[model samples]
Target: MLKIRIIPTILFNNFKLVKGISFDSWRTVGSIMQAVKIYNLREVDELIVMDISATNNKSKVDLDLVNEIANETFMPLTVGGGIKSIEDVSNLLEAGADKVSINTSTFNNDFFVKEASKMFGRQCIVASVDYKIIDKEIVIFSNSGKVSQKVKFIDHIKKMEALGAGEIILTSINLDGTMKGYDIETLSKASANVEIPIIASGGAGKLKDFTDAVKNTDVSALAAASIYHFTNTTPRDVKIYLNSEKIPVRIN
Candidate 1:
């Protein structure tokens, strides 16, 4: 079995790190730089820094800020938000991002994924999908979960894969920051549909939550913001617990 990754997600808004529940009611966490520096020491597998407001603000992720954060982040860095054009991807990569996570822009121009993949290779692209459950059905949302795409969840992920996205960051808008646990049924189904790596995000509350997803789903990585920020649980602690459960993880 391939080693599972424990990733820390940084939700950045107005130059500060924040965490929110159900993709709303965001609250400031701390200095973005400070958080990155701390994660540098935490033995995390990779780091995802998202400019949560950039899409709504009609602006691209601040390149200068990403350059600054990337300088401090020692692990593989994935940056997302308001990414539209090919140049945006190029600028981000040149600024130090190891991978670029594209969300809202893809809704308007999914061909952008194919173009980026062809230019930079699929491995450089991470297609981010945010969805919410409505009337007992999974519905896709974009623009930071404000607008509903009204598309089928499984079809959307399969589309991303077909478009050459190297991986998918599946985030449940309903479960984000709730710390209730991952939407396991949805994740398991999504995993069974895709061949590439899937980074399961949202609703990670405890150690067992991490273990459960690994044991039950084919997800390659587990990502959370609230558990690491609100609780004392660190990525290392989660890895130790997963290791105790006989799950494969990289320990250093």
Candidate 2:
């Protein structure tokens, strides 16, 4: 049995850590450095730092910030946002990112996924997808959920996997930051359609949501923000609960 991982996603805007509803209404959370240190102390499975300003602002990843977070974090670090080429991916990895997640590029030039995987290996390439159901069709969103590409969800997942992506970070724009729960329906469909590990993002409000996601979907990981950022649910407590429910989990 594979243990389900609990990861904290830190959204960056203008090189600062912020939180928002459905990826909008941004509010400052804290310094990225402070948040990384806290997650390190809590022993979370992994941490993802995404620069929401990257492509939207016509810029690249802030390596200075990446270096700061990298130096402070002890777990595997996944970085994303505004990553357009292999050179950008290389730069991020050199800055100590364990994985590079690509979103906007996939909609335009998906071959970048294979190129990135070839240069960094599949395990180091994560496909971060922003999706929403529009008129009953799962449409892909880019540019921080402002742009929607009308691609069926399964089609996109298959293409990414075939292109050598190691895993999938499927986020539900509708459920993001809502704290309602994960889009289990979407997760179930995605898991059944892809063999790669699925990381469920958005709408995690409680320990039960995490448990239900791992149990109901084939998600290898659960990613959340507000629950860990504003609420009382510690990764350790969530792990303990999952363990009690007979779900395999790594206790640190």
Candidate 3:
């Protein structure tokens, strides 16, 4: 059995770690490197650090900062935002990212997934999908959730899989930072539609929420922000709770 991964997602504004509600009204969390150091001490299974600025600013990947964080950690680091082309993916992995995640750039250039996966291997590509409830239906959001891709949520997931994206980071823009709970209907639909690992993201508020998501849906991992940023529930605590509940997770 595959041990479900407990991932702490760190968002960066410029070089500083930041957090927000519904992907807006951003606030600083701390320095990027410091956050990674804290997670390292916690012996987290993996860490996902995203550059929240690069896409909005139309900038390039901050390879220097990414490299600095990568140098401080022992586990896998997945970096996203500002990933535009194959060379950018190359630079991220070269700088120390175990995998590269792409979102906004994907709509216009999905072939990047296929080409990068072909060169870097499928396991190195993660497609971050942000969805919102529009007209009571879930649809893909792009440009940091400010715009819609006008693509049906599940169809996009299928496209990503067909294009060779190895994993899907499915996040609910409506539930982001709300601490309500994950969007299970969306998670289940995506997980059922795709054979690749699905990283269920957004709205993870407490320990039971974690258990409920995995128990109810076969997502490979659970990723969250405010629950870890604002609460005392560390990823290790989550793993412990999951183990007590009989959920298979990698324990330290």
Candidate 4:
């Protein structure tokens, strides 16, 4: 059986590590490099670093900063934000990212995901799907949750998988940075629909939340930011808890 992964997320904005409730009211957490160095010692399965401002600013991901973080990250590093072209993917991979997460570009360019996947291989492409519950419905959002894609959540992930994305990072805009818990219903449905690995993101508040999602859903990995940023709980703590609950995790 594939061991469940516990990944820590770094939301990078204006060169600082920040977190916010429901994707707004952003506040700095600490230095980006500082966070990466800390996770390196935590036995995390992987690390996701997103330049949350790059897309809104109409710029590419900060390769220099990614290179800096990549140098310190001991595990696999997935970098995202402002990834619009195959060149951007290539640059990120060259800069030390084990994978690149694509969001806005998947909606805007149409062919970028397919092209990037074909050129770089699907394993290097992580399609990021950010959504909000609108009128009791799941709506896909892009441009860092500022614009709605007007696409159904299930259709979007299926389309991304068909387009050659190796995995999907499903984040709930409603739950992001809230640390209340994950959107388990949506996560379970998504995992049922996709053959690719699904990284359950957003709203991980405590240790029970992690085990809850893993026990109830078929998600391959769990990703969180605020829980790690605001709480004393480490990734290893999460793994140990999951292990106690009979969930398979890499404890060392």
Q: Return the TM-score for each candidate structure.
A: 0.98, 0.97, 0.98, 0.98
**lDDT scores of the candidates, listed in order:** 0.93, 0.90, 0.90, 0.92
RMSD of each: 0.9, 1.0, 0.9, 0.8
Question: How do the residues 53-102 of candidate 3 rate in per-residue lDDT, one tens digit apiece?
Answer: 88879997688988898988899889999889888999999999999999
| Residue 130's lDDT in candidate 3 | 92
- By lDDT, who's the top model here? 1
**Global Cα lDDT for candidate 2:** 0.90
Error of 4 at 167 (Å): 0.4
User: For model 1, where is the 10-residue window of minimal lDDT?
Assistant: 35-44
Q: Estimate the TM-score for candidate 3.
A: 0.98
Error of 1 at 168 (Å): 0.2
The alpha-carbon lDDT assigned to residue 223 of candidate 1 equals 95
Q: Assess candidate 1 and give its lDDT.
A: 0.93
Q: Which residue pairs collide, candidate 4?
A: none
- Candidate 1 has which clashing residue pairs, if any? none
Identify the runs in model 1 with alpha carbons over 4 angstroms from their true place. none
Of models 3 and 4, which has the larger lDDT?
4
Per-residue alpha-carbon lDDT of candidate 1 for residues 1-252, written as tens digits (9 for 90 to 100)? 578999999999999899999989999989999989899977579999999998999988888998998888778999999999999999999999999999988889959999999999999999999998888999999999999996688989999999999999999999998899999999999999999999999999999999999989999999999999999999999999999999999888
